[model samples]
Target: MFRVLALALVLSVSFAGVVPNPATDGDRGEYVTLSVPENTSLGAYTLADGETTVRLPDRTVSGLVALAADPALARNLTDARVVRVPGFPRLANGGETLVLRRNGTVVDRLTYENAPESEVFADGGWRPLGATDFQTATASDVAVSAFALPDAPQRVLAALRGAEERVLLAGYTFSSPRVARVLAAAADRGVRVRVLVEGGPVGGVAVNSARVLGDLAAAGVEVRVFDGPRSRYAYHHAKYAVVDDRALVTSENWKPGGVGGHATRGWGVVLRNPAVADHLAAVHAADSTWRDGVAWSTYRANATFQDGAPATAAYRSDFAAWNGTADASVFVTPEDGHQTTLGVLRNASERLLVQQVHIDDARFLNATLDAARRGVRTRVLLGGAWYVREENRALVERLRTTARDEGLPLRARVVDPRSRFDHLHVKGVVTENAALVGSLNWNHESVVENREVMVQLRGGAVADYYARVFRADWRGGVWRLPLCVLAVTVGIVLGAAGVMWRRVSFSGSGRSGVPRRVPRPPSSR
Candidate 1:
């Protein structure tokens, strides 16, 4: 009679839809994810790894659950239901099969091989959450406007203020008071304003960002944060906004240092293209509607924020918006961004100018070097900020040394800034025929983990505009002869002069006896 009752209870709460998801080998450890039916009972159920079988705990579980080798290995999945069965077989890193059974009968099974790192497998494939494929929007005579930071802050403000129907802003960080106010005002005026920002930024959330988000929430703006245990991307680092039918994409955060024109040199563009706007809007929707996305109020309810200083200094706008037309191809990271960037580099035939905070990723650096090897003149300009000085210097030296050894037409140096703007913050690529501008940093993690956006603008006018900016920044990293070379040249000149002095008498004024000041060797200005 007791066995009959137990069977009845098991039948009452079925694990009918429960199936093994693809196994994962990520930062935490190797584990198998399962799609368990909501409120499903684990009674009479067991998981098998062909060699060993262990009964699952007799409990009710719903949603995705991780059956881990070590339950503690899935600690970062705060929202997942984790289970561990004693005597369970270890999943092989190379490949493995998992079977789920109920009442000693097979219910579901999955087979996979060589699980990828830091990626979850689902729907018969392995991919990062919120990742998208490369797509291009081509329209002849499309109105595109180019602008630079600390120069045209008004362009951003004007776009937000002009919005009548909808506004969707996505960024890694948002703490700019002026931009926040504009968003609030737009919401107040009946614009359907929405914001999506990274909840777990590199250094944690800032107090000012929290404050700004809170203010926007209070103003009735729909605010969401990409956070929680099941976050799709490692970081929601894309910066762009869709205001009605216009799209504004930038390499800067919507902070005082960025759009507020206070600090950092950045590149931005406003495209009056419906297709572009629609594409970005779709991206925002996908990132914000997922399970990991949390309402601003909900995220802030239990979160503590750190104090941060806001950038306050202002500067005059030097680069005005360049109005032009171009075909734009959009790419998102952890998906097709890296490939698109590589395509741009590989296609360079005449010259390649790269301006970035830093290029730590070997793949990108190698691609740039390959361009130089192909006889394409290449110039790599890295940031000169105090924080990145040492690393940038080392990287610059390595690149220069490689160029010298290989006899490639490549030059690399740290930016001098020259007071044009504070530290280099732009992540831009200018080739002979194309320009890529967006928020993707040239790094492994950025291209493989973070949610980044980049646009390749194809047209002579657009390429020329960005190339112009690149040239200006490149000049800031002034080129000078190496100290050794300069020393050798000076030694040769001085030796020749001494030989001449011994051979011929100079008919000059007595003042000529006084040593003429030798011009100093060129500096890394």
Candidate 2:
């Protein structure tokens, strides 16, 4: 008892100015806490795998309290940033509340009976800050906002144009002149652009990386290729970017074929904060499992690292990682096995928000249902328009049925440019107040075949933005199709996987067609 109180006292004094914030910023994003007034009920706010239920007319509105009470809400929180809703000190309202914090200090708070954006609700343009009611500030304000891409691709390009410093991109393949130009321009202007490509050992995605590195190098970018290894696990597949403290951890490799395999589209987060950026950098640093580097003789091999820079990133002591505990929690499998992630999400106290390009595992489904039935809100966002695989269709049906039975929310999204493969292979979880990200997937390969990378980020801006993006995807962010239509259309969509599968399998053979062994130089010649 003394220990707990003593810890609190220490925290209070050391962070004397730092209040017991109801809000926290996770590596992925920031989450603000808003206390509803006594007896006022909150409309439900649902995201990919989590939900937060507000009880109105409450004596307090601690984001921490809400998340702690519900596992579903807690998983996504990762951090709780505390803010006092003014007037009622329990309620805040209005656009005027935008100034709630000035120069990083909370000042005036707004009190209102209803949401100030009521007028903008009709348009598809309204961006929710947190929940309805002028409660706490938005998840975005606490974090660097994604380029509002769902609105326009130009917005994405515009975001690229805004880069000022360093850019580290890791992807499976990249072959877009436009993208290359963008990286080149960023480099020419003095932005450091380092690219780690998954090449050779893994289906020659390295070849793809080589192509981009060559171009970027000519364009004056600092590039490097990490040749993936084939040891006891699968090849590496991680896509992300770190521009200073802002980062992007993605399921899609930023390539001409973004997220490969149309039966599913990939999803990624444009992290606009330090925590997430640093966390991702560490993850990138730890991919020692992918150490097979190949020299691309055909493509531009000039994308070599400068001699002064470190040849490889030094692995930071995992113990020294600064993941805070703010009622928000993050746990890593801490092993090569990705299946452990299922246990993490399934054990949530409030909600679990899961987004993936592909989710058809029986264990995965069982876990979701199990968590939901236990009174934990469980929501899942799966691939919709991009994939036409029969197996994927079956998984979709299973997810839908489970959602129906458990009263959990399950959604599907169609990645735009459905013709090309979309890479939505991110494996992360937002359970109540915690968020985790990595290269793990809800697939057989992820569990046994792949040696994946995953990280647990605590209390920051990245987690909240991650929560918001998950919410947006769950609410049918880009997919305009009805549920049935999406499922039905799955049978006859682009058919890229089917065609590609047939093309490769038919052209290749075994035995006599075996990879020829280099003639042993007359071992005894």
Candidate 3:
């Protein structure tokens, strides 16, 4: 009898320890994320919404389970186990209560109120999905080597070749054959080399990029891709590399069009600072070491690559490298990049110069306009690439119209490369006191969802260096008479010439004893 009692006691303890833990309640409206305790089987468990109860699948959950109502949301979660709970109780946006039971006994319960949209609640707080907590780092009097793209590609190549210990390259895309060759050479010299790139860029990964990554892997370089359904950021879009004690941050990709100097105007800087390099290295380690960062070979095995022609056009170098020491603050997104950049725009007391692919983000556009309204001179130069030409032209017209209507000291135009380089691919800002250069695009998604890197150089000299480049590019983007205006001007001049010819012809005809009428000149409207 005593033995039977002890067995019963042991069984009760085992069952009690197996209860599921309610970790997070993701009330993303339309769907919910049910955080199940790891290694805990839900075979005897049912989840209830105080009305209907559904039995969970009889399997051990890895960690997170999604109860999605939308089929599309279920499809997007390729990595996570999802239950399509048709008629699943909709999570009340304002508040709700959920309960989990095992064998008709309550195991866990969750109660939340005023749930924020598209955010996950856990550990007594709510945060957006994949949000990071990186803080801005300020390093004073750091040596910086600044260079402009299509002009100082060699600067990047030389930095890689000079890596004596390690090279951690992070980028949105990597397909530069020249850069690949240099990295391979560095690896062969016993320098540790690792590369991290986005596995699922827009339109999918390119065939050339896959080929380049394959070659790097074969050459003994550790190459990883930020992919899989558990990815933290929507996209790993930072374009920077940590080489030994130096960090090279840029607004361009690793493709031929970007750092290879084949095309695309960009801004880059090589910081010879240990602290900055360590900070970037830590970020790389955290990102690359995550479960979502899969090996390139593994990702390529299942990826369908898209066909693309490599950028091969060459251009003459226009700007030389500018070396100086300045106070720099490094920032990354979706953490401090947005706030730090807004600080830069809001604090501009004199003038603001911005060069970018385009400014589609309303918040940033408003900030720029607000600066102009505050008596700060503002100029925005946008890329003139074929893909963005129409949109940029339309945006330029809108800004011009607004400026004229409000009488703001703001001017915006599209760049004309003029054989200097290809389209403007720079995401840079220049003020009298500071300059920002990096991969952060001025867009809501890029600021809040994508992983980006930017550095603010706080010094007049650094600002002046980029300011000079902006001035040159601004001149290239200078507004000229529109075709219609030019056509009207030519029409007026030709009409005047014709009127003179008609008067002279009439006089000549009068001499021939026949009266003739002279045509009047056209009016200039």
Number of backbone-clashing residue pairs for each candidate, in the order shown = 1, 69, 0
Sliding window of 10 residues with minimal summed lDDT for model 3:
13-22
Candidate 1's residue-wise lDDT over 301-397, tens digit each? 9898998898876555557889878888777877774678999999999989999898888888999999999999999999999888999999999
Of the candidates shown, which would achieve the greatest lDDT relative to the real structure?
A: 3
lDDT of 2 by residue, 282-375 (tens): 5544442222333334224443322111111111111111222222211122233534466566667776787765764567767777777777
> Tens digit of lDDT per residue, candidate 3, span 1-525?
999966633332121011011112342224455556557666776767777787766776656666555545443422346656655666665666677677887756677667654455555566544345678878999999999998889998977887899999999999999999999999999999999999999888899999999999999999999997647788999999999999999999999999998888999999989999999998898788866789988998898999999888777766898999999989998877468888999999898999989888888899999999999999999989888899999999999999999999999999988767868999999998999999988878898888899999998988988988898888873434656898999888898888777776666556677757655555432
lDDT of 2: 0.44
**For model 1, which pairs clash?**
151-317
- Angstrom error of the Cα, residue 3, model 3: value is 50
Which one is best on TM-score? 1
Q: What value does the lDDT take at residue 107 in candidate 1? A: 70
